[model samples]
Target: MTRLFTVPLAGAFALLLAAAGCGGSSTHDSTGDASVTIRIPDPGNEGLLALGKKDGSLAKALAVVHAKVAWTGSSGPFAPAAQELGADKLDVAQGSITSAIAALAQHPGFKLFAQIAPNKTGEGILVRKGSPIASVRDLAGRKVAVNKGGTAEYLLLKALASAGVPAGRVTRVYLNPAQTAPVFNSGQVDAWAVWSTYSIPEIASTGARFVATGGQIGSQNYSVWAVRNGFADAHPAVVQAFSRYLHDAGVRQAQNPASYVNVFTDAGPQAVSGTARRLTIQDLAQTAAPDGIRPSNVTDFDAVARFFAEQKITPTAVNVRPYVLSLTGSGS
Candidate 1:
């Protein structure tokens, strides 16, 4: 019999142990069918939610192997539950190149198998549309909000440093994206170092503009699908299947940007405008690869590891070369 372990919701991270859940034997059901419960990290992220429900790529791919996939949202990026699932809890965890790198550096047991979204233009320095701060340099001596430990903070630090903005040139206001939006609009912060998706439109409503785009700063970033070391080892075939589905999703996301817009509109609660829709599509396409999977030359994982090391975010520098799994291309 498979033992079931119940976890309280507030436990930072919960261990979902169930025969059909987490624990038990890694075997098929009584109907002689294999069960594949994929805990897609951050399922509620508008882009990911739409992909899982509408794209059908994940469903279609898993069906061929007789697996039943289930979705769950994490409190934040890859949590302890995700690490535990290793390969099982979440076949694929979607995160920015920086986040993925940081996660791996911290855990040392995680590996990324496929590229889900290119980390292009996901971030920008948000100011009023016609704000005086037209470039990253303009933000010197201004208050900027950065989400600590997230891509926003890492990118902001690098961008500011390159712009020759002295450490004290800008006031660093640490806040989660949620809190930053309000403060940014109220002028509590002079500018916001935030993601384009959420902060872009929010700042736009306030007549705020982008002072710097990731592309303008030559920041090449991408998101990836990650798995745990042991999980992938125990179930390489399952990992491959999940990786393929994610790659296909990227293909569909790229091929039909408009269709994806509609999908997001239908599946998401956010009211995306025509202009916003176009921008979102454009950003999505920027990260799309030919086969939807390839080694990223843009992100220097080692450099990232070093950054984390300096910041004391990770105990040691991680060599990501061995852990990176390549999807090659479609059907690879």
Candidate 2:
């Protein structure tokens, strides 16, 4: 019944609030005890957010200043979530700097308040094992599924370019991750340009191999938190406090992702078991260590923007320096 894009933005916002039992509260109380209830997307087996929610650590940390946390909307793509933030329907959500760039190109609503370094080792182009697609060169003239205008397309394009395959040669089938699965499994698409979530699981369980990892093919997607500008301006302390909570939780996950895997991946539909569980744990441990919420690096994002613009993913290049904000308070 709740459609994110089908209804007007205001209507969608109202629906989300009603669905989440939110009282449409946005601003902090005048006393500034951080009593404002922060609304964010429901964390669904999503790394540190899931970890924090499962243990009640996020709420406990926010309660220090009398702030409350509300989980609104289903965990989904960052594109719609970005729109929700812009409309003041939600206060915060997990996003990538690339997604933030794409959002800003369309409209203004949120500013990236914090950043996490990219872990591209596990995000790559997934292909059937022994499929004859030995390298990026083999992708030429083939259909590849990629979510347009973001990391998926970017990674694939970079891989193709590295191998000197003209963009026009390969047919890029624009499909979201959910839509791409069946087509990919049926061999309708030669490869799936996907993030670690799907890539890791598929590789561990299914007989899938990466034509090239993001690292090997040269692509970067930094994890970041985007906050509604209104909320950040109205309650700076709340933002800082919440960011600090996320940073600390990220630290714990980064330190030992294997230790937290039971809770982190437990909520998903399929239980990761056997060899899949072992391999997933290994990949997560390596990828998690180098990442945590941290300060924004404008230069790296500029590179991302330039690539998207060249690929015509964005209407034009977007300058992200203004939106790259550094809120106080984070873990060591």
Candidate 3:
């Protein structure tokens, strides 16, 4: 039996109430009426699910396999979505590679199947204008805002380690992406480690400067899509169809980003401006290997797992390969 865990409804499942009637389960429906419940972050620009919903492409593609998509809104970090998946409340979701690894370490049924290309434009450590923190080395003993176990935390760790700063010296302020901007802008935090979604808008509004970027610190942050293993096994055809749909939609966005005006528009002016500044047509392109899990991905995941273990974020080292789903034969 799958162990069901409870998460704070107000925190993680705040947006989920809107889709209350859309039920989810681990067992695939054998009656030929198959459906998938996917958790998409509000204003999610990284995946095709949101864009496809607007353009009707997702519906058209899933129709080929006689499957349907039930879209649910997600907020904050990927932990909530991962928890929902583990509890059999979600069929598919996307999140940062670090968060996915952390989730897989805790949960047993999740599988990473596809990946989004890494973009270096927006991920970095930001300090307020005229702040004395001029470099990664300056972060020692400073209060830094980062979403715990998310990409921001991972990048901060890598940056600090690379700069020879003792991880224990920095005081980390864990906040959701929504809460990060307010704390950072109000000077409550010395620095904010964030990605494009929060960093771009903050910089544009507050003139915050980048102390160091993921690229500068040699951190590669890739976003990945994952699904429940039982669902994929029981409905391979549906999984393949959804993966192909995402790939095709990603290609379209890469070739013509302007085609996704609705997506940018829905994300708000700040997000719109951020998207324009941080993303390029090429950055949205699907460059993932056919198998989805590349050697570099494995190595990076292992490194993150080891880091988490060293930091006592995880109880033990986790091997990530067994949970990776190879879509090479999916015919996408």
Winning model by TM-score: 2
Q: What is the C-alpha lDDT of each candidate?
A: 0.58, 0.72, 0.67
Which candidate would rank higher by lDDT, 2 or 3? 2
**TM-score of each prediction:** 0.76, 0.84, 0.80
Q: Which stretches of candidate 2 lie over 4 Å from their true place?
A: 1-34, 264-270, 288-296, 328-332
Candidate 1 lDDT over 9-52, as tens digits, reads: 22211211222234553433223436655555544434534666
In the range 51-102, model 3's lDDT, one tens digit per residue, is: 7777778878666556676766654467888888777777887778888877
Q: Of the candidates shown, which would achieve the greatest lDDT relative to the real structure?
A: 2
lDDT of 2 by residue, 67-173 (tens): 78898987667888898988879999876677788889996788776676676677878898669898989998899999867678878888888888999999999
Worst 10 residues of 3 by lDDT: 1-10
- List runs of model 1 lying over 4 Å from the truth: 1-33, 42-52, 74-91, 116-118, 262-268, 289-299, 308-316, 326-332
Candidate 1 colliding pairs, count: 9
